[model samples]
Target: MLLFGTAGIPASTKTNGDTVAGLKRIAELGLGGMEIEFVRGVYLKDNMVPPVAYVGKKLGLKLSCHAPYYLNLNHADEVRRRQAGGVLHHAAGTAARAGARTIVFHAGYYLKGSPETVYDAIKAEMEVVLGKLLDEGTEITLRPELAGKISQFGNLAEILKLSRELPGVAPAIDFAHLHASTGRYNSYPEFAEVLNRVGEALGRESLDDLHLHVSGIEYAKTGERRHLNLAESDFRYDELLQALADVKAGGLLICESPNIEEDTLLLQRTYLDLSPRT
Candidate 1:
């Protein structure tokens, strides 16, 4: 079954409140998973992991993580490149401790190089990071997310290629990013093509065990500008859900809308209703 959840905890929680409490609350809401938003940085202390894991296990909530946005695998400076690798390493470690299976990250930006050159540099850096994680015995998977702009290092084709080359790497296909990056393709046939391509390139197992981010987004010629709430944006989510159900894609689908919990439930309910058996 496909698990649906919000990108982070409900906004009602105070900044000083407990993160474990947030996990329990999400489970209480009937959500099946939560993407711990380490987008700013990794802040989960070692002492908190046991309690968080306990709560997650009791509640049956699947866990995933979003790495910080500061990563840049293609940095021109060697020092910066190594630092980026360290960031990924830290994120991977934290994800494993939190009982999360996948750690999603924005790979990098394409500053002034050709796409091919940037892709090669990013792939090389990812290999180094993955090697370190494997040596350390971390079981978490590193997911390079499909970014939401033209200037980002990750596109569907580029990320899929990287996943093919790297042993443990996978693509986090953000549907909002896909829509913004291409300016269109929200229909059932278009979405099906995406699933077909991924299945063909990465294998059926990869398609079944997907990690996705979905929301309504505003875009321009340059690509995604900002995320909008489901009701406020023009995202054709019904068709998208149908496409996922059609493929029987089973993994975490995290909602990044402004009304996070509300949109997440909407997606879960919509998917259930649109599912083929129904």
Candidate 2:
């Protein structure tokens, strides 16, 4: 039931083409979805939303979103924290208008705070943001991504707890990040454990509607350095996909490799080979 796609437009998409054009290319490539990357900002203009939604609907593509990189909901500075919250709110509104199912973002860094303190701060901040989104009737799912670095605020347990405690919030499970962050979870059993933990923590329904990011990653002891093509790294994507298939996990699996469309296709093909469900 998983829908495979790129994080943004396919690389083969024509230069100067918009996301509407990207949707067409995704449909042509047989991808079932795309993540509209608001990595810099909510760049999908207000005027373009209808068309983006229309094209995505026509093609049966599930759209999701990644918020800007700089957003840190638990920033140490009050001003920056408020700004981050504002950006997230704006991004969610736009994504919802465009028919996106989820908006993924990094929650924050650990900085000098204890994990307990950081988690509480992030939860409090996100509660306010979610409250605002709800007041505006914007129901787009908020996904705090499982981060790749040790210094980052989010980890598997942290994300699970966040999703468990927060309304409108869920985990954006990045397999590369998990592997890079821990130097483990690169095997079928480890991958299966992750799925089991999510289901255990958030319920089986969460697994049924998972949001995932996949890539081959380079890492140091500190954590993720960069993304690599699946063929170029030790991500064990085949086993990871196998674990997903075994669990019957369903959701949008967005590929974030440098070779976006190619690796996306590889993930789709490999997952299909492992599971009867498309």
Candidate 3:
């Protein structure tokens, strides 16, 4: 099924910001999953994952993770690479134990070179990261999200190709990033094109269990400015829902809007109410 949930601990969750409490809240709200936000840093303790995993499993909630925000694989400096690698390594183990099948990250930036150069560097870095994680016996999908900004290393093609090339890698296709990156892709047709491309590149199974991000985005000429609540922006989310329904895309849709549960519920309700021709 296409599960809907928030990007972090929901605001309405009681228990003073505990994750298990958040899971219980999600269940109470009739949401199906959540992406544990380690975006600032990977601070999860060694003992924490098992209980989180247990709670999620018991509650029938699917879990996933967002890795730290400071990664940049295209860098020549080994310090940044090492730092990013350690975080990804820690994230894989933590996410796996937390019952998270995928860990999404913004791969890198294109600071000063061709896209080809950036792609190759990032891919090489990912190879090392994946290899280390596998050796450590942490099995989690490493997803390079399509970043927002003309200067970012990841676009749709780059992320998809990375998924196709790497064994344990996938695309975390963020619709907001796509829209912000090019100032288009808000229509139903554009949305379908994206779904079609994902199916074409990674196959039907990937479509059935895709990881995606959706939010109302604010953008400038260069790229994304900030996130907004879905109702407060011109995101054409209704059309996006119709497209998602048409393709029968499943897996988790983590809402990244400012008002997390409100937008998540809005998308969930809209998706459930969609007709193929709507």
Candidate 4:
């Protein structure tokens, strides 16, 4: 079940149009899923849930949420670190209300700390958040994304290790971020190794039900700057799609391209063309 979708509402829709309506419109466009961009803040008020959930259920759309990017669980101040947990808690709760199965977030920044120290700090903070979610009976999985920049805490191995150490958590493998972060290793063998490593550390189910973010991204000596449309960027998406098909990865691939729907459809078409027929 290869799921292809856009990061947010399609560009053709009016800005700040009704979210539920926008989702319905995108579903009609034949996209398999939609990711609510809570990158700034979690904006779904309590009153909005019923309508949003109603439309999402009616349209059979798979929903996920990207939590705010302002998180830094490894902050030097304990107060600020606790605030980050609160933000994640709010985002997780809001995502559950919106019928989202996964709540994605950037785990933290390195901030002059050793990777081991930062990982331990992040793990401790996530344990608190996970406990809170369990107490509140929220079923949405918390996903720490692969950060593009080397300075950030999240790397492929770090996120994978965190998921292994924590319950009810997983890695959101942003392929573009992996490409940029590693300075370009997007071949079929490299991609296969990535899936293999995640499966080896986490489990086969993690790969099957993966949550992914994909786009052609711009980067430099450090890492990701911004996302570009597939046509404008140098990402080897065709080979990537083939690798995914070979693995039978069964989850959402949300496109974060500037031209969201167009690139998403391009991905969908490419995957379908590359996948072997039964």
Q: All models: lDDT?
A: 0.90, 0.92, 0.90, 0.89
What's the C-alpha lDDT at position 97 in model 1?
85
Q: Which residue pairs show backbone clashes in model 4? A: none
Which parts of model 3 are misplaced by more than 4 Å?
Answer: none
Q: Write model 2 residue lDDT over 197-239, tens digit each, in one string.
A: 9999999899899999999999999899999999999989988
In the predicted model 1, the residue pairs found to clash are none
User: What is candidate 1's CA lDDT for residue 28?
Assistant: 76
How high a TM-score does candidate 3 get? 0.97
Q: How far off is residue 263 in model 4, in Å?
A: 0.2
lDDT per residue, candidate 4, 1-278, as tens digits?
97888898888666554688679778878988899988999877789987887888888989999999998899989999999999999999899888888999998999989999999999999999999999989999999999999888899888998899888999999999999988877788898888889889988898788998999999998999999998999999987888889888888999999998899999998898886422
Q: Write the per-residue lDDT of candidate 3 for residues 28-117, one digit (tens) a residue.
A: 999999999989887667787788999999999989999988878776687887777777778777888899999999888899879998
Candidate 3: pairs in clash: none
Best by lDDT: 2
